[model samples]
Structures are given as structure tokens and as C-alpha cells.
Target chain A: MRVSLSTLRILVLLGVFIATVLFFASQIDGYMNARLFNRISGSVAVIALIAVGQAFVVLTRNIDLSIGSVVGCTAYFTGGILMAWPDLPPVLVPVLAMAIGAAFGAFNGFLVARFRLPSIIVTLATLAIFRSILVQSSDGSSITTDRLPAWLTEFATMNAFTVGDLQVRWIVVISLLVVLTAHVFLTRFRAGRTFYAIGSNPDAAAFAGLNAARTIFLAFVISGALAGLAGFLFLSRFGNITVVAGLGLELKSVGAVVVGGVNIFGGSGNVLGVLIGAALIDLIDTSLVRWALVSEFWREAVLGLLILLAVAADTVLMRRLLRRKGGAA
Target chain B: MTWMRSWEGFLFLVLVLIYALNAWTSPVFLTVGNQINMVQLSVEKIIVALVMTFVIINGEIDLSVASVMGLAACAFGWMVQAGVPGGWAIVIALGIGLACGAFNALFIVGFGIPSLVVTLATMIAFRGFARVLVEDRGISGFPDWFNALGQRGLVGPVPLAIIMFAVLAVLAFLILQRTAFGRKVYFIGANRAVAEYSGLDVRSVKIRIFIASGTVSALAGIMFAARVGAIRGDIAQGFELDIITMVLLGGVSIFGGAGTMSGTILAILIVLALRNGMALQNITGHIQTGVLGVLLILSVMVPIIRETGSRLLARVR
Candidate 1:
């Protein structure tokens, strides 16, 4: 059996990720080691959820730059609602957030799919618009931990399991559930496979009787819904919601999706790959903190470099793969 | 009647209606002083938007423009504050701008990487580099003459920045309207494969456009630093959205191949007038930003809607 390029890339990244963590764990103190894993799991939880959803959209050869803003907007919506009515069940928070996110996503789909506007520009515009709405509604103030109901904050920090001394939070479990569900849908469902068909070649997909626009729209809507879910996780984990709650998240998710072996041009990748990609990004962040060699400012710069390297490698590898196939035929 | 069917005509009518509304609502809206001030505030964005017009027209985007502006300004501020001569600092800033543009071109034009992703990476990377340079601190104390030039006018009530922008806009207009290069840009944007088969240097044209965008953005940064009299790494952080908004609102298709400088100029004025009137009415900055976002969406949506409507009509006929 031929090992596909995406699977191979993920394997290599996973290997590098484990080796880096093991090497650093041996060199660092026990407290720092626990701290490193804690940060990785916690941060990766929210990012993985967002990245998984984003992978769907990117797999359709369209990008969503508005998810970060959607996250911020949805978090504020949930946060605002909880503050206004403390008796609201904690479960309702994520539901409301997902609904709001889906609405925004539908709007984006309407423009991109119905009208056929470029997705990037449509999302960029919405990013600004959604963020401004969040700001205006909040009156430029943050909903802090004090305002959050006790149960909501408790759920945020609830420990799911312990690995020796390192405790895993419930958010990690939820993130895993999201990933597994998405993985199954993408691998097992006809609707999920259509996304790849659309991304690979929309014209061909259309000719083959696939509803390309509908599939693309579904991908974006799913991405938006997941981002909204991540917002709730963010609220629980941080216990604070500001106008800038999820700033720069769009780039971070894109970075993870690309690094996770998803083609930037779309048509390939999986939820499991995004999980590892999200872990690698968070690991890099935590490692930089643990080593204390580089300033915190370098994190974004490093993420940028990682995105470039990931995309460049994918492009080169893909060309080589195609050439091999062509030669054989 | 035919002109009314065109995008520029629609923009002109909108501009007129907005101008009238402002005049009716605000007693000072008709004053030349306030109008000049409005232009001054948006001049930097306008200048960058013109170059962006070319980029979008050529079927690519430069998301790194705002970051390049921020980076160039930071570099200039660091140099001048460190006692480098202002003249030399300006040259160095332009050179940095050129290098930044070339970097984008290398990935996009050379490697065939999507310009959107390449520019997105540079946008973050370049902004990161700027933040590392200036951190949270703001640098000031530019040469007196330079500050005056950036903030004040050569002619009565005409800012040097605004004048420089006008000259550049005219030059861009000519290059885009009257030159063979401009036609080539449209050709490539309309169909890159066809342009390549027709013997056009598609890669080189794309490279040149990205470079132009970078350089113009850098220049805008210098003027911005002069206007503000300080430089911070986070300066112009979200300006890319506004520049792109203005260009698109001016009727430049986001997919490329159809737009004009006149339309962009008209759109910029409309935005300026709207923001200026809102400021006069004491509207919050957040609300103003929201309005621009709505305008951005509507700009693209209207065209799509019109085309769809027309297609439906034709099918029925």
C-alpha cells in the first residue's frame, strides 16, 4: 500500500513533536514538565476544535478568515447572556454560541456560494464587521471571571483524568470528542467526501452531479459552528471575555491546518492530522516559554515561518508525487 | 443613461447623496477646512488603496501592505531616533519596503504559492518583526521639517502627504489606464493561462505588482509616522482592511479584472464623508467601523446581486 503524502507528513510531524517533548522533558524540572503538558493540552483544546472546522473549509479550497472574529463574537454572546441571566444552564451557553456562529457562517456562505464572491475577501469583511458588532454590543468592556456563574467557571477547570502528576482538563476531552466526530464524518460520510471533490475541482464536481456550492457552504457552516463551540471552551478556560477574546486566532488555526498536512489549496487532510497540527503549534508555544530562550513576541513570527514551511513542503511534495504518477502512467 | 448602468455612475450618485446628507445634518460639513481635514486623515489609506487597486486588478492581493507600512515606519523611527540623518533614513525605509515586496514576490511569483497565503504569512511575520523592533514603546522626535511635511501643507491648507498622495494616484491612474502594462495586467487577471499562452510574462507582472504594493505601503508608513510624529510596531495594524474595503467599495472586483482609479477615488471620498459626518455627530469609533464593514459587504453583494438578477432576466427572456 502506498502511504499518501498527507499521512506521511502527519507521521513525520508526530514523530518530531514527540521527540521534542521527550528531549525537553528530560532536561526540564518536574514542575516545568507538568506545566508544559498542562499548557499544551489546554491551549490545543480550543485551537484543535477551531482547526478541525477550518480544515473542512480549507478542504473545499476556500478559507474562512472570519472564524477568529466569530469566536470572539460568539464568546461575547454567550458571556453576555450568562451575565444577564445567571440561571441559564451552562449547557445553553455553547448552544447559543454555535447558533450565532452558524448564522454568521450562513451569511458568509450566502455571499461565497450563492453570489460566488471570493471567500477570503467576504470573510475578511465579516471579520471586521463581526468584531465591531461584538465591541459595540459590549460597550467596549469585558465580562470578567467575577461575572461568570460559578458553575460555568467550574466546568472550565474540571479535571477529567490524571497522568501521574499531570492532570487533564475536561476541555481536552471535549476537544477529542469534536475531533473524533469530525474524523468519522469526513471519512465515513458521503457529504463529507463531497467537500474534497468540490475543493479538488469544482467544475468537475459539478459535472459529476455533485452540489459543489452546497457542499462548500456546508463546510463553511460547519467551520463556523465549531469555532463557536471553541468560543465556549475559551470562555470556560479563560473565564474572561474581552472584545479581543480570540484575536489572531484565524491565522493560528490556518497555521495548524496547514501544518497538520492539510493542503492550503484544499482537497486533502483529516481531523486526526489537525489534532497533531494543533498540538505541534501549542507545543512550540509552550516550549518557547519553557526554554526562556526567545521572547514571547517570537511566537507569532515562528507560527508564520511554520505556515510558510508547511505550505512550501506540501507544494513541493505534491509536485513530486504527481510527476511520479505521470511517469508511471 | 448608459453611464448610470455603470459602477462608477452608481458610486457618483451615492457620493452625491451622502454629501447632501452631511451638508443637511451638520452646519460645518460644507466648510473646506473640515473637508481638508477629512482628506488628511484618510490620505495614507487612499494612497495605499491606489496601489492595491492595481494588485486586485491583476488578480492577486497583498495582505501584507499594512504590516509593511508598520514595519517601514518602525524602521524609519528607529533609525532617525538613533541619529541617522533623516534623508538617509527615508532612503533606507524605501529600500526596506522594496525588500519586503520582493520577499512576497519570491514566494508568490517564483514558487507559484497562492498570493493570499504568502501575503498572510508575511503580514504576520513582518508585523512580528516590527513589534520586536519597537515593542510597546512609541518613538518620536522626527526632524522638525519632516514632521511639518507629513503633518502640514506646502500650499495653503494642502498637506504635503495629501499632495504626495495625489501625485502618486495620478501616476497610478496613467499607468493603469493608458499604458500597455495596464492592459497586460487586465489580460493576466482575466485569464492567467490565456495570458501565459499569449506570451505575457505572467510571473514578472505579478512580481512587479506586489513590489509596487509593498513600496507604496512603505511610503504611506513614512508619511503616517510623520503625520503622527511617532512610530509603534502596532501602527496601521488593521489598515489593510480599510484599504481593501475602499478599493472594493470603489467597485474593483475582488476576483480582479474590472475596476478603475476614478471609482476608488470616489469611494474613498464617500467613506471619508460618512466617517467625517459621523464624527461630527459624535458617533463612536466602533460604530463607524461597523458601518465600514457593512459598506464592505454591501459593495460586493450589490454587484453579485445585480449580476444574478441580470442573468435571471436573460434566462427568462
Candidate 2:
């Protein structure tokens, strides 16, 4: 009958998310509809993938600030490849995008794992480096919808199934699969457990015979690959690929990971929470645009406030819970 | 041998080489006007970087510095547009900066939250506030005197900003190297638990450092407004990372407690020189930023690489 602290946190988050949605639904006329779900769900899919990747990195006690730039790089390159080889198989495009993303991730991993460089600094540098590479490669041109294949554009809205007025797209299904797969791996597998072990206490993990460096490196690689998959989804969702694509996604992904009840200090959190976190953020964002009282300028402010409150609440609640538990023990 | 072994010494040699390379490529590379122009263009970021060195060395970060800069500048512009006197607007902008810093300090010191997460939130919030104040609008047409403070030289061939930079750099060096407060900063950074155990007022010191970071960032924003003769929400949008890069490249340990003002000054100069040299050679700005990113990485890695190489050599011997 005992529930874990993480489980309690997740339940609280879910409650908050539902309450907010209800509040928005009551205020905005005609807010409870399939169109709103379709819009928020589509964008949530992209944010969820990156957030899941970021969750992996956070679980390893590190961060990948370059994921945004990695998304931009992979998205642009994938678009260019599809444009060049229009007759190529549709299945290979995402694979190619993931490969490109993995390469960028490997570069980050090498510096952080091999040199013991700080993850924040290393990824911060690579964020610029990767974006600059994209800028130089793109050379002022952008890949518009006209240049991309019809199948790719169609894939964005292609429905997996429908129930009444609600429709589920393939991208949403893909992102959910990725999240569920990551959730299982982190919870059920030993190799995946190493990430939490390293993050919680690196010195202890080392003493326990874990290869801390390799695990950290693997975390970065997985983050990179997920970002790449998100990039492919991005290209499909938005047929235009600009150099500035995915520019501020790093902030959004980090925000989602933290707001999802995942410990920012790294170690205890689940990808299911991240999925909810991403949904909550995207829901707020889309709702704000429709709300007449709040200006669009307040969107970033709201996101910032949410992150601050989430972190603060997590700290306060956890302290009280732990104190009570300590007394019982 | 000792000088060669030092990070600053190695940076000085790199600075000299870049100077030589620039001088050979562009005839105007060594001119006083071009040199002053180079310093003027980045004076705001360098000023903030000086304070940022303190923040980082104190074992924390202020990701919101750039956002504070933007907010301060926009606040000043908003006030001026509403017919506030030029002098009072400047003071209010700085006050706003102080408030911003105190806000960051409250979350970090009072709540015991991590500085990184707190500042990251503020970074977004502050920028959003700036955007709200001046949504897609650029405010300009400041008083001539204010513009002169940034655009015209106060001393012959030197503007007011450069003067402020010089004074602040000296003050920073003296305080960091010669004062007891500076020692406390290092001690706290090296090990906060030990410093607290030793009876140092860790919370007060941290609060002061963050407040200083906020106030300095605001001052830089004011300077930016004066220099550009305009203000917008996106002013200094991505300058935080660039400023941090300069400090980290100066050999300041990101983990805190170990860095010198002299190293930071050298790094500022090296970055300025590198950018100027590349600009003179007609390289694109993006490419220049990319090069600096590489430099940021190499700066941290070089010491480690050198240590490993030496270890390998010793093993062979």
C-alpha cells in the first residue's frame, strides 16, 4: 500500500495538469474540442521527444544544451537529403537523421566523457558550434515545402486512428512509443539503471564498479539520437527548414524535464512525467494565444514562472516528506 | 619556464600572434581608432564578464544576466519614452537591475534552491518582461549628452564606457586579490560546507555577489542603450553565453574558487583581438562565433590535455 515519493510527485503533477486544463476550458469559449487537442498534441509530440532525451541526460547528472542545435542541424540536413533524393525510400529518412544526430552527440560525449569537461560548458560550446555548422552549410538558403517530397509533408497530418472527433497522428504515436520504450528501459533494465546509479552518487557508483564515463557518454548519445528523431518529426510537421529552426528548444526541453517532476539535480524521475510536462507546457502555450486577456508577450514569462514554482514546490514538499519519513524510520 | 607554464602567459603569446597575423593582413589592424572601435563594440559584455567572473568563482551562475541587461535597457527606454528625465531614468534602470539581482538572491539564498535552475527561470522571466515593455518596437532619440557618453570620447580618443571599464577592472582586481571579502568568496566556492562550518556568513556573501552581478549587468545594459542610441527587447539577447565564454576561457574554473582577474582581462583582450582579426580578414560573424566556441572548448581541454601528455611522457621516461 506504500507509494514512492516519485509516484506521489507524478500524481500531484497529473492533478495540477488536469486542473489547469479545466480552468482554461472554463474560461475560453469552445475550448474543449478536437481541433485544440490535435494542435496541442502535435506540438507536444515534438517537445516530448526532446524532453525525454533531456530526461536521460539529466538522469546521468549532466545536460545537453546542444540538443536544440542538434535538432536544427539534423532537421536541415534531413530536409536537404530528401530534397536531393526525392525518390529515396521514406523509411530511410529518419534513420539518416538519427545517424547525423548521433554523430553530433558523439562529439559532445567525447569531450565530456574523455576530458572530464563540465557538461554545461561542453554542450554550451557545441550548441554554438553545431548551429554555426548549420549556418555555414545552409549558406543563407532555406528548404521550403516546395522543395520537399509530398509524402513527407503528408506524413505530418497522416492519422494513425480516429475515435469520434478525436484523431491520433502517426507522429504522436511515434513519440509515445519512444517515451514508453525509454520509460521501460530506465525502469526495467540494468544497463539503464546505471544512469540513475551514476547520477545519484558518482563516487559510490564508481566504487560499485560502474563505468561512470561510459554511462555518461551513452546518456549524451541517446539524447542526441532522440533529438534527431524529433528533428525528423519537425521537418515533417513544418515543411520549411530554416537555419534558425529549433532555436529556443533547449530551454523548452529543459523546462519540460524539470516541470515533469524529474529531479533537476538528477536521478529520480520518469519519462511518463515528462510526457505530461510537455503536454502541460504546450497546452498553456496554445491556450495563451487564444486567451484575449493575456498578451503573447507573457508566454515566456509564464513558462519561466512555472519552472520556478515547480522547482520550489518540489524542494519544499520533498523536505517535509523526507523529514516525516525520517521520524518514522 | 614558469611563465610559459601559466595559462595567462600562454594566452599572452596567442594574443601577440593574433596581433601579428592581423597586422600582416589588414593595414588598419593596429590603428588606434580600429582598436578603440573593437573595444567599444564589446565594452558592455566585457563589463558584465568582469562581474560574472566573481559570480562563477563564487560557485554559482547568473544565466539571467543578459536578460537583466535587456530588461534594464528596455525599462530605461520605456521611462524615457514616458517623459522621465534622462538622469533619473538611468538611476531607475540601475535600481531595476538591483531589484532583479535581489530576486535571484532570494530564490538561491533563501529557498536553498540551485542557482542554475533559479537563474534559468529568471532568464526567461526577465526577457519576457522586457518584451512586454517594448513589444517589437525600438525606442531611440536619447538626449545628446547621454549619447555622447557612449558615442563621443570623454577623454581624448577614449569614451566614457572605456573609462568605466578601466576603473572597474582595477577595482575588481584589487577587491578580488587584496581584500578579505575576496578571500571569503574563494573559501565559500572551494567548499561551502567547510566555509559555513568555519563560521563564515555564507548566505550574506552569496546574496551580495548575486546583487553585484545584477547591478553590474544593469549598468552594462545602460551603457549599451547609450552606445546604440536605442533600446529593444532583444538587446543583448545572446550575450550571456559569450560573456561566460570569456571568463571560462580566461582559465577560471567553472566549478568555482579558482581564477584571477588578470586571467579574465587577458581573456577579454584575446577574444576582442580574435574577433577583430577575423573581421579584418573578412570572415563572417557566425564563423567568428564558431571559432570562439572552439576556443571555449579548447581552453578547458588544453590544460587537461597537457597534464595527460606530461603523464604519458613521465611514464615513458
Residue range B133-231, candidate 2, lDDT tens digits:
998899998889999999988999899989999999999999988999999999999899999999999999999999999999999999999999999
Candidate 1: segments with Cα more than 4 A from true spot: A19-32, B308-317
For candidate 2, write residues A199-314 as lDDT tens digits.
Answer: 98999999999999999888898889999999999999999989999998998999999999888888888899999999999999899889888887888888898899989988
* Model 2 bad stretches (over 4 Å): B309-317
**For this target, which candidate reaches the highest DockQ against the unseen true structure?**
2
lDDT value, residue A104 of candidate 1: 82
TM-score of chain A of each: 0.95, 0.98
Root-mean-square deviation (CA) per prediction: 2.1, 1.5
lDDT by residue (B1-317, candidate 1, tens digit) is 99887888988999999999999999999898898888888777889999999999889989999999999999999999789999999989988999999999998988889889999989988898887777778999999999998777789988887778789888988999999999998888888889999999988898899888889888999989989999987999988888888999998887788889899888988998999999999998777877887888888776766788789999999
**Candidate 1 global lDDT:** 0.87
Clashing pairs in 2: none
Best by lDDT: 2
Interface DockQ of candidate 1: 0.65
